[model samples]
Target: MVQSDSKLHEVALQKLNDRGVELKEIAELVYDLQSPYLAELTMQPCLESVKAVIRKREVQNAILTGIELDVLTEEGKLSSPLQEIIEEDESLYGIDEILALSIVNVYGSIGFTNYGFLDKTKPKLIKRLDDHTHSNKTHTFLDDIVGAIAAAAASRLAHDNPGISKIMK
Candidate 1:
């Protein structure tokens, strides 16, 4: 039997693939964008950083936070003031993106650019996740966020090692 962690990885990969993002593409993008500063760290080290973000429960927390907000909104449990606050997806509450930023920070400025592009593009699963906000489901946002984090983390892995791209291809 696959370990729970490995199973999670597999699920994450499936979610990412479903949205049209491939591990190879992500890896190629990372490899192509490497700079002198980032190059010094080596791909494995960078990958470790990305993995750490996932392993450390940071990604899990982001998912939970987003989902909880959705739950509050759906249940009509949020007071007017609180509802107004979360509705904005406010600049101050950028902790989700910030947590994501940690993964990219491993590669310096390039990672930031990559994250921005991914976040804005909402390519594949990301787009589906944003759409899921309208649906009634448990952990809707959280499930998608977990998938997104996995994709981002996987992409970081590919970026660190070009060889991984070849295998995926």
Candidate 2:
């Protein structure tokens, strides 16, 4: 049976795909985060966790909202102050982080720490996304959103595995 929100989920997935973010990329971030804790870890569970996090309605909404803003910024569609703040990804303009926190909040406390670590480390694909010099596209929101996804996915994996879940706590 299809959930009524399946369309939203598909769009969320598509938006990330359109932005050139593959599930495998986020899964790699997940694998990196959980590996030290889980020596026997495999990419399959990390990929599964990323998929499950993206499947959430909350995550879908954040993906849609953030991507829309980035697209608008790229097209120069937003107004002066707001556009500049997002385009430059100003340090003081923390609204992007706040939006990201919403996604992290879904998985409870563990996600917050995980998100912090990823945000600071900018591991793997996230580093590429956040690199302003590499691309003209402004990932102002996408960077944080992508980080949140990886963090939340890692948190989900930790929660699912009782042994590491405690270590996470």
Candidate 3:
């Protein structure tokens, strides 16, 4: 990665941290998605996949944009119904999911299905991020970003290790 890319990566990571997201949380989601498919798996590769996904410029932009919007909403800086829509995470407010798909689209078609599953299940960390009742924080975008990262990482992991599928065939 170039210096500018490195800077973007660093800032994206920082934004995730600022939003209370840990890499382990994302990695755990990857494990949950891939472990059932892999005969034997470890968190190390899952973590590596997440790091790889985060390094992508596309993902960095999504992270920055989504988190900025969520922060703006939380601070009540966004305007009118737009703010209310994002804050409430209204079912019709599919923009968040649309932005998240940009991150998942990087990997492959598998990511689409993985993202759907994670989004529907709302696994532990995602569940926490999605909780609007406990605090004034807004994760309307962060939660989807987190799920997208995991879905992308899981897709990468599946692509990297195809031994199981090869054996099955």
Give TM per candidate: 0.48, 0.93, 0.95
Instruction: Give me the overall lDDT of model 2.
Output: 0.91
Q: Give the TM-score of candidate 1.
A: 0.48
lDDT value, residue 154 of candidate 2: 91
lDDT of 1: 0.50
Better of 1 and 2 by TM-score: 2
Model 2, position 48, has a per-residue lDDT of 96
lDDT of candidate 1 over 1-169, digit per residue (tens): 6336656555555544544445444443333334332434345544454455455444534544555666676676789866655454544655556545654454456455556766666555455545646644333344335434444554555455565343444
Cα lDDT computed for each candidate against the true fold:
0.50, 0.91, 0.94
lDDT: worst 10-residue window of model 2: 160-169
RMSD of each: 8.3, 2.9, 2.1
lDDT of 3 by residue, 77-160 (tens): 999999899989998889999999999999999999999999999999999999888978999999999999999999999998
- Candidate 3 clashing pairs, residues 3+ apart or interchain: none
